[model samples]
Target chain A: MSRIKAVDILAGGFVVLIGVLAIVESTSFDMGTSRRIGPGYFPFYVGVLMVLLGLVIAVENLWTRTASDFGWSLPPMRSPFLILAAVAAFAVMIERFGMFPSIFVAVFLGSLADTNTSIWQKLTISVAVPAVCVAIFKYGLSLNVDVIRWRP
Target chain B: MSDFASNLALGFSVAFSWQAMWYCFVGVTLGTFIGVLPGIGALAAIALLLPLTFGMEPAHALIMLAGIYYGSNYGGSTASILLNLPGTPSSAVTCIEGYPMSQQGRAGVALFMTAIASFIGSICGMLIMAIFSPPIAALAFSFSAPEFFSLMVLGMVAASTLASGSPIKGLAMIGLGLILGMVGRDLYSGLLRFSYGVDQLYEGLPLVAVALGIFGLPEVIKNAGQITGRTVEARSISFASMWPTRDDWRRSWGAMFRGTGLGSFFGALPGTGGLLASFMSYATERRVAKDPSRFGKGAIEGIAGPEAANNAAVQTAFIPTLTLGIPGDIVMAIMLGALTIHGIQPGVSVINNHPDLFWGLLVSFLFGNLMLLILNIPLIGLWVRILAIPYWVLYPFIIAFICIGVYSVSNSVVDLYVLMFFGVLGILMNILRFEPAPLVLGLILGPMLEENLRRSLTLYRGSYTVFLTRPISALFIGIAVLILAWTIYGMFRARARRRAALAAGGE
Candidate 1:
C-alpha cells in the first residue's frame, strides 16, 4: 500500500477501536424508558455512525491508489525535548515554589534551548521577569498568591 | 428592549472605570505577547490566569479575558505571515496564502493588510452586535431542543465543505470526530460510555489536552529537528509602515464587508465556530475576487478577507453565549464555565437582574477590540523580529512555556503527563496527515450534541420523526438532504471523468 493509504488505514483502525469502546460503554447503560431516552442513546448512535465512517475510510484506502504527498520531516528534536523537560521540571516544582518562581525558571531554562545564549544572561532574564511579575501581581495589585513560601 | 438599553448604560458606567480600563489594557498586552508566540494560545493563557480571576469581580475578570481573546486574534496573524506558523485558529487561513507572500518578500504587505482587515471586521461585527443584539437575543431564547440538534447537524455537515484537497476525507474525519465526541458518560443516564473503567475516562477527553497535543506538540516536533538549522534568507522585516495603500483598501473593502456578514452569521450558529468562519472567508474571497488564480499565491485579498471574517466571528460569537446560554465556541464554553462557577446564569433575565454584568461585558468587549487594534499594530515590528530568532533558541522555550502553562491549569502533574501523551499523539497525527481540527470540533461539540439529541429523542418517545415533524428540524433535514445530493453528484461526475481519462490512456 502507498504510505498515505497506510497512514489512513492505521488512523481509521484507531478510530474504529474508539468507536467500538464507545458502543460497548453506551450499551452498558439502561438507555431509560420510552418517554425519556437515557444519556447513552445519542452516544450509541454517534458511536455506530463513527464506526461506519471509519469503515468507509478503510475501504476507500484499500480501493484507491493513495496520493504521493505524505511524509513527516522536520529540523531537529533536541531543543524541543529540552524545552519539554524544563516544563516538566517546572510543573514538579510549582506547588513547592508557587507560580512566581516556577514560571521564571521554566522560561529561563527554556530560553537555553538555544545553545548560543550565555548562561549569565539567561539567569538574569529568568530571575528578573518572574521577580517583576511577583511584585506586580502579588505586592502592587494585591492579586493573591504565595510569593516567597520556602524563603519564609 | 428599553430595559436592555438601560442595562447597557449601567454596564458602560462600570466598564469605563479606570480600574477596568487598566485591566483591559493589561489583558490585551498579555494577549498580544502570547499571540506573537507560536503554539501558545489564548486558551492556555486564560487557563493559567483563571486562578487569579477567582478573587476579582466577575465583570472585571471577564472584560480582561475578553481582551485576551481579541488581542490574540490580532497577534496570531503576525507570526503566520512572517514564519508560516499560525498563532491561533483565526490566523490559520492567513497562512494558507499569506506565508507564500512572505516567501516572495511581500511580508510587509501581508502584515499591513491583515491588520487593516482585522480592525475593519472587528468594527463591523461590533456594530452588528450592537444593532441586532436585542432581536437576536430574543430569538435565541426561543430555541428548543430540536432546533439546537438541527443547528449542530448543520454545523457538522457544513464543516464537510471546509478542506480543499479531499472533501470525502474531511467528511470521514468529521464523522470519526463526532463518534469520539460520544465517548464518556451519557449525561442523562449517568452511565459511562467508553471509559474502560479508568476514572479519568469518565470525563472522556480533555479538550485542552487534545488541542495542545494535536496542534501544539506536532508543531514542536516538526520544528525540533530544525532547532539549529537556519534555512531562510534573513530579509529585513518591514517596521516602517502600518497602513495599506488606497488601492489595496479599494480591493479589500468589498471582501471585508461580505466577510463580516458571513462571519457574523457563522459565529451565531451553534457548533459552526471560527474554523468554518476562516475557511468560508477564504473560499468566498477566492470565488469573488477578479483574479481567482491569485488565491493561495501571494494575494493580499487572501489575507484581508479571512482575517476580517475571523475577528468578526470572534466578536459575534458572544451573541449566542450571552443571550441563549449556548456557547458558540470552545472559548465561549470556557467562559460559560467561569460564569456558572460564579453562580451567574445567562439568559434574557440576566439583562434585568445584573445590569452591571450585561452592559459592562458588552462595553468592555468594544473597548477591548479597540485596545487590541491600537496595541497590536506597533508591536508587529517586535513580533517580526522574533521570527528572526533561530529555531534552536525558539523551540525549547516554546516547549517549556507550554509545560508551565499546562501545569498551571490545575497545578496537576497528571495534566502534564496528559499533555505529553497528547503532544506525541499530535505528532503522530501530523505524520499520518490526519487533521486535528475536526477532532477538536467534535470534542467541543460532543456534550452539547448528546444533551440536545437525547432531549429531542425523549420528547419524541421512540418516533425518530420529531427531527422531521418539527418545523426547524425539518428545515435542517431538508437542507442536509440537498447538500448530500449535491456532493454525491459532484463525486459521480469526478469519478466518470477519471474513468474516461483512464480509457483514453489504455487506447
Candidate 2:
C-alpha cells in the first residue's frame, strides 16, 4: 500500500512536470548573462523553483501525517464535462451558426447537467435564454457578431 | 487644506455632471441586482459590461465600473443575511453571523446595519484614498526598476501566503499563472512562448475571458441545480422592524470602526483585498466579544464588522491600483485592464496625467454609497423577491451571458476556446482545494514582474547584488524573506501538532 497521500503526490507531480516542460522549452531561447538577461532567464529560474517546491510537497507526507484521507477519489465528472461541453459547443457553433443557435445549443446542453430538469423545462430554457441574449447582446449592446452567420 | 478643497471642487465638477451621475446610478442599480443574486460575482458582472463601455468616455466608464465594484460589496451582504448564500467571496464571512440573525427574525435589522456599516466603511476608505494617494503617488515616482521588482516579489509572496489555502499550493498556483501569462510573445525578443500557432493568442490571453472562466463558470457548475428557491418571511423584514435595538447599536459601532480600520490597512497593502479584510474583521470581532458564544448565533458585531471591512477594502483597493500601477485584488486587476483598454496607462503618473480621472472617481464613491444606502433600505423588498428566483432559471441565463460576454471581448472564437479551457481548469483547481484568487494576481502581475526583473538586471550591469544593495529594494526583499520564513515556521509547527495528535490517537 502507498503511504503517500495520492492527491498531494499527483498534484505535486503535475507541478513538477509543468516546471520541467517550462525549463526544457526555455533552453531554446538565448541564455544571456545577468547584465543583459535573455527571455529564458526568469522562466528558467522560476521553473527550477517550481520543481523544488513540487518535490517538497510530494515528499511532505513522509515527515508529517496529514488529517486528510489517504485514498484518492475522483471528482464527479458529469457536471464538469457537461459544463465544458456546453461552452465548447457554443464556441464551435457560434461563428458558423451565429448567436441564436449557438446560445440555444449551449443552454440546452448546460441545462442537461442539472439532471432534475425535465426535457420540457430544458427546451423552454433553451428558447428563453437565446431570446434574452439576442435582445441584450444583439439589440441592446449592438455586438458586431452576426445573428445568423452562414459565411465566414 | 486649500489645495484639498480645490481638488474636491474639481472632482465634484467632473462627477456631478448629468452623464456621469446617470451612469453611476445605472451601474449601482445593476450592481445591487447582481449582488443579491448568488453564484455570480462582481468580476463576471464587470467583464460582461466591459464591452458595452466601448462608446463612452473613459472617465465615465470608469466611474460607472467603480460604482458597480463597491456597490456589489454593499449588495453582497444581502444574500448572506437573507438566504445564507454569499453573493461574492468577500461576503462569505457575513453569512456566519448574518444568517443566524435572520433565522432569529432580525433579518431586517441585519440588512439595515450592513448598509450603515458599508456606508461608514466606504466613506472612511474614500477619505483615506483621497488623503494618502497624492503622497503615495509622489513617493512611487522615485521608485526605479529594482524597487518595482522587489515590490512585485513581495506582492506575490503576500498574496500566495495570505490567501485562503495552503501556502505552498498558493505559490504553485502563482507559478502556474506566471507560466500561463507567458503565452504571448516576449516583449524584448519578440519570440512567441506558448501561443502554439494560434494567431489570436499573439497578444496573450484575454483577461476578461480568463477571469470569467476561472471565477464565474466554476460557480455555475457547482451550484447548477443545488440552489433552490428561498422564500423570505414577511414579518421578519418589515420597515418598522429594521431598527436595531439599543444593545445592538452599542455592540455594533465599535466593531464597525475596528473593521473599517483593519480593512483600510489591509486594502492599502498590495495584493491583499476585501475578502481577507472581511475574514479578519469577523475573526477579530469574535475574539473581542464579551460572550463569544453569541457570535455564530446572531451576534450583530459579526455582520457589522465584515460588511464594513469588505466595503472599506473595496474603496481602498484602488489606492495601489491608481497610484502604483499594481492591482490590490482581482477586481482591481479587471479595472486596470479596463483602463488599459481605454488607452490610459495606470501608474504614479496617472494622478498627474489625469487628475480629473483620479479625483472624480474618488468623489463618485460618496454619491455611489449614498445611492446604495437608499437602494438597500427602502427597496429591500425588491431584492428579497429577487432571491426567490430558482437557480435553474438563473444559471442558464448566466451561461448564455458568459458565452456572449467572452465572445464580445475581441470578437474571436479563440478567446472562447481559452474561456472553456480555464473553465475546466477552474473546476480542477476546486477539486484540488486550491484557491483561484492568487492565480489571478499572479497572471495580472506576471508581465510586470518579468519586465521589472529584466530592467533591473540590465541597469545593474549583470550584478545580482544590486537587489540587496539598493535600500528600498533591500527593504522589500527583507520583508518578503521574513514573511516566507514565518509561513514556513507556522507550517512546521502545525505539522508537529498534527503528528502529536496522531501519536496520541494511536496510543
Winning candidate number (TM-score): 2
User: What are the runs in model 1 whose C-alpha is more than 4 Å off?
Assistant: A62-152, B1-4, B43-52, B80-86, B92-110, B160-210, B225-244, B273-302, B325-359, B378-380, B386-397, B484-494, B500-507
Q: Candidate 2, B308: how far from true, in Å?
A: 0.7
TM-score of each: 0.80, 0.97
Give the per-residue lDDT digits (tens) of candidate 2, residues A1-152.
26346767876887798799889878988878898888888788888988987887787656554556455467677777888889999999998989999999999999988888889999999999999889887898788877888754
Output the chain A TM-score of model 2. Answer: 0.91
Evaluate model 1 with DockQ and give the value.
Answer: 0.35
Each model's lDDT comes to 0.68, 0.87
Tens-place lDDT digits, model 2, residues B1-507: 898898899899989999999989988988998888988899889987887887899989999998888888888989999889899889999999999988888899999999999999999999999999999888888999999889888888888888777788889888888887888889999988867788678788898899999998998998887776466654436789899999999999999999999999889888889999999999999999989988789899998998899899999989989998888887898898899889998777788799999989989999989999999999888888888788889999999988888888778888888998899889878866668887887788888888888888899887879889999899999999998999888888878887788799995
Model 2 in CAPRI terms: which quality? medium
Winning model by DockQ: 2
Candidate 2 chain B lDDT trough over 10 residues, lowest sum: B228-237
